[model samples]
Target chain A: MSIRYPNGKKFEKKRIFSGQKNVNNKDDRFSNRGMSLEEDINETNDYYRAHQIAVIHKKPTPLQIVKVNYPKRSAAVVTEAYFKKPSTTDYNGVFQGKYIDFEAKETRNKTSFPLKNFHEHQIQHMKEVMQHNGIAFALLKFSLLDEVYLLEAHELMSFYDKQDTNRKSIPKKEIEERGHLIPFGYHPRIDYLKIIDKMIDRC
Target chain B: MSIRYPNGKKFEKKRIFSGQKNVNNKDDRFSNRGMSLEEDINETNDYYRAHQIAVIHKKPTPLQIVKVNYPKRSAAVVTEAYFKKPSTTDYNGVFQGKYIDFEAKETRNKTSFPLKNFHEHQIQHMKEVMQHNGIAFALLKFSLLDEVYLLEAHELMSFYDKQDTNRKSIPKKEIEERGHLIPFGYHPRIDYLKIIDKMIDRC
Candidate 1:
């Protein structure tokens, strides 16, 4: 399961730890101890898939490979490649006969979530998703606060635009007021579909 | 850009040449001279995107890297990686508020498409997509015959299942009769969405 780099260095799984000191220590049914936000979302996706509730999946990281080595009677080996920025959001799939797409990110900052975390291409992609009548949103996890919120793409886009003239980050209060709080659950740790249900109801 | 393999050999694009010798020579608006089926489909997807029709994209080839070299003032380079079989279909995205997922393959056989072109994991993935109420199908292109068909996942799954005891190939006659013929157009070369529209109408 462990991967090594060309330089003989092992690949490190980047973990964004929370800044809070007094977070709950008890592991809830939904909690997997020491799991990162990305790991939690992946587990939730698997849960949804196993139950036949949805078919969402995180797109594989894009890579631009320049050179490869094909040994006779063996698998091809990539010798040179660089990571590429994704053109769309992380997660997308079908739920209740609807097109669902969203990006999930975690921030350790307690006061505000930095807008710089998202790229312009990703923002443009969400806008396109919304224009096509597909449900688009962001799963913003305030790791320090132990809180997750589902913010609509429109809200995120608006804040992103304001960064050019106004504040560069989305204040915690704005997110709390505008975003739908997603309650963690046992089987599906981050029950995002629950928030999606409400959004669908409103529509 | 050209790529080189580890054995000092240049990577060549695998093309399935047509089996028939009497194919048409006239340049049709739908036809992009010397382009492979994959290239044409990519162009069609781009056409769809420009027209606000859909946002489908082919997932990048999955690679499991074991080595990389990170140097200062440059992006990290992957030194050793192996290809992995994808767990889902190639092209997937939202189309007209519906979740769309599909696999596209080109064949050189004049009689029937060899079932060996598809893998069991792919069949299972399509079944999962169907279970989630997503639109799942296969774009089968007979390169020699210069014909393309939009075959439903159910049709493919049934034929795939029969391969265990029945014929290993799906006869061309069976495919033509059961699958919808996708008309080629100037802008969006393979207009498979027309077939999807008919399918939706039937539903």
Candidate 2:
């Protein structure tokens, strides 16, 4: 079946479900199959943090807390709050003494990942990260194909700078050609650190 | 004058204003010192992070988000949320390839810093940090005196373990002698990297 976003971008639902099912069973969408990419990455990060392999976490969205209610004998309840502008990338941490920063996004697109997926602030943050010698990248999940790719910030910046005239999206063929493919596994399902190791080596 | 918290902790107003404040000159309150110690440390960590010096940030209080509202043209608003069990310290990041973890607290007591200021779960988290070869500490601020100290997790653990019979607080003299004094300065106001440097040297 086909699924299209509000922005008129077409997506194939088949790509979103491909290898998502458990390899040990026939039911891919069953409860036993697996968790989402975000969950897998969170779990992998937890493992990495525990083992001291690397320290990384998803940065919480900045919020402007306005009103808080303190009950008689309970925790404070935030009655009113608002979203604040995020000054940096969505995720950042240290890896093997190197600064790591990135954003994670998943799409069901079988053809390309749209440039509109990223914001101008995120691009600016990436540029800042690069200026400070930080390793910045994006974890792009082609959910339909159940594949993930780590595209370096430098490449993303290049695309962003030329996005005005070039294609509004990064083609899957180009992603395969330029980005590091992250293989899924049982333990540390995303195994992003392996790609991180490669990135470190390149650096 | 004195201020009382719901917990019945009495806080004495330390600074006495002599004259009416000018438009440009503002009084520095405990909250307005341009980000709490937690924030200054986080900024230092960011600086460290960008410079590959350290990775650290204040851990968000774990909240079980129960309800979210998606407005037609706005960001998602969390309407209902509850605090969840936090598994780690308030702040943690990587430094010089070492996992750095810490909790921060402010006290008004001029004689001693109370043991009750820290939660049991926080103590447990510190223990876990130690088990993982992480450098853990607490940044204690005597707000009235504008003094901050970096007390190691081991010392805190030792104090906590002896809470049954020993004094309920660690005397300021003890902290002065044992804990590293973090001198306040410009740029990174509460320049904690200097303390971290000393701690790193000790390690």
Candidate 3:
């Protein structure tokens, strides 16, 4: 599936060409693909914030900053820091009086999105958001196909809970059947709020 | 004019010892003495967010990242960056359906809070907020007396506008007479919502 921006500009998937012959190219993973999913989501978030369409932002990675160096006549630099476990989803904010929360991920696999893409902490975070009556979802981008799908957290949780005995990955067809396809746009890029409106209407 | 925490803990005011001369002392003008005003306000905001009382946060300083190093197997590290000119106040969020925006500052001067403590961009930002029907204000702390006040942006603008011919600072006595004193509390620490409640009531 191909995605088109608001002005009819088509977004093509980026490919990596390497000279190394012995490199394992058959194994597909997000990190190995070189295109950062976080960066793209952040860009889309900035577009949303600038247009006042939404106020979502990625929470700063929690850090336990232990020591700082106060160099002579300069800004203090953090010298020693460690990452701390995050208690919430990566992105959250208010949009039109509704609390919105979501996590974004990309996968290079052509057939399925792996259940391992999410963590236990993130699952728990989404559960808490659901308990609080907040809208929670995940943006899954099939990088190779240039398609983005907004999958509700409830749907994801159902798949996650059966991961131990069932298939370790969710088929792409399942997502297409159950998830909302988010179209890219000019002003807000990923206009997820359109999907949000539908979800609220259904509720 | 002295203030104490809700638990009755006295805030310690930093003092310059007589005859202690050092180059670092010259740099103290820009540096926070101790328990930074920004840090304290952030803590207060944390309290607000956790309790669902409000959703305020300091905007991350916009940075023009110049150089980034991409290691073979590590996350990208920003090596050099500089702050961009911000077009809005440092802090903003929603409080009970009202958009709230504010800047925070601390002064050691006993008689007055210097107008120079504020930046031109901050003033412009507050003006824009007012134009959008947003509540704008400044949280000023007098470090010498451990007192904090919520001074409305309009009151600050009036003082700032007269600074060309009048004194360059707002007298402490005037602030005491006009500004809303923020009471500290065990849960919220700054308890700024009391002043916000009064503002909403007036509206």
Instruction: Give the interface RMSD of each candidate.
Output: 3.4, 5.7, 6.3
RMSD (CA, Å), each prediction = 7.5, 8.2, 10.6
Which digits, one per residue and each the tens of the lDDT, describe model 3 over residues A37-83? 56556778777656666656665554444444557898545444444
Q: Write the per-residue lDDT of candidate 2 for residues B133-177, one digit (tens) a residue.
A: 667788888766778998998988887888775688888998999
Model-by-model lDDT, in order? 0.78, 0.67, 0.67
Which docking band does candidate 1 fall into? acceptable
Per-model tally of clashing residue pairs: 6, 5, 0
Candidate 1: where are CA atoms >4 Å away?
A: A1-33, B1-33
Q: State the lDDT of candidate 1 residue by residue for A1-203, as single tens digits.
A: 98875662222112233222111212211223455567778899999989988888877777787777769999778888888888988788889878899988777677899787787898989998998889999999876567889999999988998786467889999999999888777789899998888778988
Which pairs of residues clash in candidate 3, taking residues 3 or more apart in a chain or in different chains?
Answer: none
Please give the ranking of all candidate structures by DockQ, highest first, separated by commas.
1, 2, 3
Candidate 2 lDDT over A39-146, as tens digits, reads 777888888877777656765545555555669898767655655555666676656556677887766677888777787887877776676566778998876678
| lDDT, model 2 | 0.67
Q: Give the distance in Å from residue B182's predicted Cα in candidate 2 to where it truly belongs.
A: 2.2
